[model samples]
Target: MAKKKKTPNDKNVMAQNKKARHDYAILDTYEAGMVLTGTEIKSIRARRITLQDGFAQIRNGEAWLMNVHIDEYAEGNRFNHDPLRNRKLLLHKKEIKKLQDAVSDKGITLIPLRIYLKNGVAKVLIGVAKGKHEYDKRETLKRRDQQRQIDRVMKRY
Candidate 1:
């Protein structure tokens, strides 16, 4: 019998909202499928996507991703989809209910963390987050600075 080698993940991340992690405390994360057009997928494949100001909302028992901008494919021409259109997120009914309940609480929000392809399918990592206060954000910055200083000191030894 021949030995098989494991392949590393080569899926390219389309876009990531790094600010979301810095500005918000993520309580839970869920991977949900995104409904995209053919051109949209092509655009995503080319990494022409932005998730800086994107969010997820549970409406009418379904999840919708809003403000996710996928640029038009240069080769698609007239068949290209809208740039900032709302895309539906595919989640199970039970998971949707859970997310809706968590979102209903005060001071909690739905933030899109990143968009990536898993097994050739587009998936969005949605985070259940709570906005951080100014002092909290400052504390995070302080800790990060302290950690950097410690790393520098250790590297010199």
Candidate 2:
């Protein structure tokens, strides 16, 4: 028998860490599968997740996601998973080594950028990032405002 595919909601994004972009300059990104509990997946499907403070780390030849908040399922009773527990990220050995090497540099870190469901499986997009300086943020904001102004003027035509 052939396996069925569940791809209707392809790239269904559940949560995004908007602050991560403002706080860090992303250098590279990798999509990683997550090891989630039953209730945790339920909560995620309901869009009750917050990725604001989440980050990924490579340890013991594995990738781990930390500080992500997935709300507990209301009907989960005693089986509900912890909202802020560290979750294991499924990544290839080579990817884990690459991430480990990337973070070994000064000021470079691994951060979670977004959580999305791809083919019914929960995945996290991790970014290899460097902390942005205060002035870099201001520059980004300035450029954004200028783009908005330009677009506004063009929209008048």
Clashing pairs in 1: none
Q: For residues 54-153, write the lDDT of model 2, one tens digit per residue.
A: 8888878889999999999998898779999999999988899999999999999999888888878998889999999999999999999999999999
Model 1 residue-pair collision total: 0
lDDT of each: 0.91, 0.90
Expressed as tens digits, the lDDT of each residue in 74-138 for candidate 1 is: 99977789999999999999999999999999999999988888778988889999999999999
- What's model 2's lDDT at 88? 97
State how far residue 74 of model 1 sits from its true place (Å): 0.9
| TM-score quality measure for candidate 1 | 0.90
Candidate 2: list runs displaced more than 4 Å.
1-11
